[model samples]
Target: MSSDPGEPARRALERARQSIQKIHQAAIRHRDPSLHEIADEMSEVALILGHDAGPVQDWRPCPVCGAEPGSHCIQRPGHEMVNGMHPERSRL
Candidate 1:
């Protein structure tokens, strides 16, 4: 299915949240609590999804350093464009 750039990222975030919720429910059913680990995993997933989403609003924080927005955090440059290709074109 074709989707806008932001659409796919949002979908990924939704999927990650759904997966986390399922894990929570499974934990409850199995009587084995691993909520902390589940939460950590969710956070990691969300962070990755957010990065993939790109700069929607503004550069909030340095994803690597977790520094506050507007702080002098080192920013990793986005992917370089291939010759004759538009900036939005995906290499994938």
Candidate 2:
């Protein structure tokens, strides 16, 4: 094959494109908020409005973000790790 100096950059751009696509997929897959945390936040809002407290319940850690305090972070399960240009799903 004839050597082309731009081949490496082209390949790099393609790799970057694939990587960005994987991130996009991950974000789309994990865009929902936690229902439990939603309720908690609603309760806080109610209190601000002079209403009764919202429902209080134990915070459950997302499997992807294990052991972290409730911040309602998105959980993509096995997608936390990179496998090639895509994220590998967690089997846990």
Candidate 3:
């Protein structure tokens, strides 16, 4: 029924990693007792709030066939497009 007073802030920071780093840093710097816990929480938070992997540019090249940047992954021979898969960072 009752949650830790810091729970709300922690939860918020967990979801607010990308946009609120400075705020999280300031808060974390001031709080020493739970420094480890905060560090751990922020690690997970960064992953959760990090890059937008859903975009095509975020995908990796197809292991089945080497493709060019901004190009569709072709499962060659028949040359089928793997629409489900996008490329990772561009080669450049």
lDDT of each: 0.44, 0.42, 0.42
Specify the highest-lDDT model's number. 1
Q: TM-score, each model?
A: 0.41, 0.32, 0.26
Scored by lDDT, model 3 comes in at 0.42
Worst 10 residues of 1 by lDDT: 53-62
RMSD of 1: 13.3
lDDT rank order: 1, 3, 2
Once fitted onto the true fold, the runs of candidate 3 whose alpha carbons sit more than 4 angstroms away are 1-46, 50-53, 57-59, 77-92
Number of colliding residue pairs in model 2: 3
**Tens digit per residue, CA lDDT, model 1, 4-92:** 76888678767766665555455545655465245445555656655332221111323444433223443335633234222332111
Q: Is candidate 1 or candidate 2 better by TM-score?
A: 1
Clashing residue pairs in candidate 3, if any? 59-87, 59-88, 60-87, 60-88
Candidate 1 stretches greater than 4 Å from native: 1-3, 44-92
lDDT, candidate 2, residue 43?
51
- The candidate with the higher lDDT, 2 or 3, is 3
Greater TM-score among 2 and 3 belongs to 2
> Residue-wise lDDT of candidate 3 within 4-86, one digit each (tens)?
89787666654654434443344445644244335335455555766222222222334446543234565556444434332
